[model samples]
Target: MAIKITGFYQLPHQTMPELVDFDEVFDTSFMRKYTRFRTFEKFLQGSRLKIENQRDFEALPEEKMDAWVRKATKFSSWQEMLDTATDKYVMHKNM
Candidate 1:
């Protein structure tokens, strides 16, 4: 629907290659990254992902979550976001 309007159905058609290596180094425990953010709501505001609460986020259907992640962050998937956020957190902490 929206894709039809934008005429950019191809805008989000990138094939996400599997991400490795950093998966082992990043710590993605619960809302750790969200906590590091100014606020959880603010994080969502910058993104298209939406849910009423933690349970809502968890209960979101797999396809919907995947699409939300694709729309919500710069990364191709949530895992990439996690890995990048972890790196940023580490770098900022050490600075």
Candidate 2:
């Protein structure tokens, strides 16, 4: 289940497990959208898919990039991920 964080932009410190490139993120494979992709590359891919134009993925809008990333991943949004993210330094935390 996803947790709803109120404030403190500090996510639970989770790891981006299914990080992928822009090409793969929007390569006619909707599966990528459900994956936990990170970086501006994947975010750009998602945004491109939404716009469906010749716009340079690299130059995609920066404002909504985070939203695009959240839609492609399992988290509700960047804010949610940031709030409920689990720490990586302590691998034993999940153990």
Candidate 3:
């Protein structure tokens, strides 16, 4: 008999990417548009990509928005958001 593994599996921790260092690399001027950022310095210390203001992110240029989307989807715990087809679908399901 042959055995097959399927369903859910916990990936080894080594497969995970390292956390990004926002302070060292994030562009404050670019990031500021994603919020009413009181101060660029303060924003880095407090902002969580998962909690960004959608309207503010939308106001940014296409390239910037794409970067944010990639960052949030690829690095954050809410990675499943990237797997979905569209924002409207996500909204519809939420409703």
Candidate 4:
């Protein structure tokens, strides 16, 4: 029972643990609009996802960053440009 309760308490936190892109939060709009965003904001505020420091977030490489964002957004573009943008955002904190 203790394990079950602990599992239940952590369910929401575990819902989208691989979330590297902010846009991924929008993918769940059908089920609960803005709910994911709110949860993500909470996660950020609590520093549970390493978003507390801009430099730390910026430290991530662009290609890796874009790979996640591209999966989350419906943006249409050349894969190369997308890759570049992803890196730029990681380094400079742009969308």
Best by lDDT: 1
lDDT of 4 by residue, 44-81 (tens): 34333344445645564655545543443343332543
Per-residue lDDT of 1-95 in model 3, one digit per residue for the tens?
A: 11121122122333554332333222343345434443334542243333244344334365543554555333222223222322333343346
Q: What is the C-alpha RMSD of each candidate to the true structure, in Å?
A: 13.5, 11.6, 18.0, 15.8
TM per model? 0.43, 0.29, 0.23, 0.29
Prediction 3 global C-alpha lDDT:
0.35
Q: After superposition, how far is residue 1 of candidate 1 from its true place, in Å?
A: 28
Which residue ranges in model 1 land beyond 4 Å of their true spot? 1-50
Q: Which sections of candidate 2 miss by over 4 Å?
A: 1-40, 49-63, 83-86, 89-95
Judging by TM-score against the true structure, name the best candidate: 1
Window of ten residues with lowest summed lDDT in model 3: 1-10
lDDT of each: 0.44, 0.40, 0.35, 0.36
Q: What is candidate 3's CA lDDT for residue 78? A: 22
lDDT for model 2, on a 0 to 1 scale? Answer: 0.40
Better of 1 and 2 by lDDT: 1
TM-score: model 3 vs. ground truth = 0.23
TM-score-based ranking: 1, 4, 2, 3
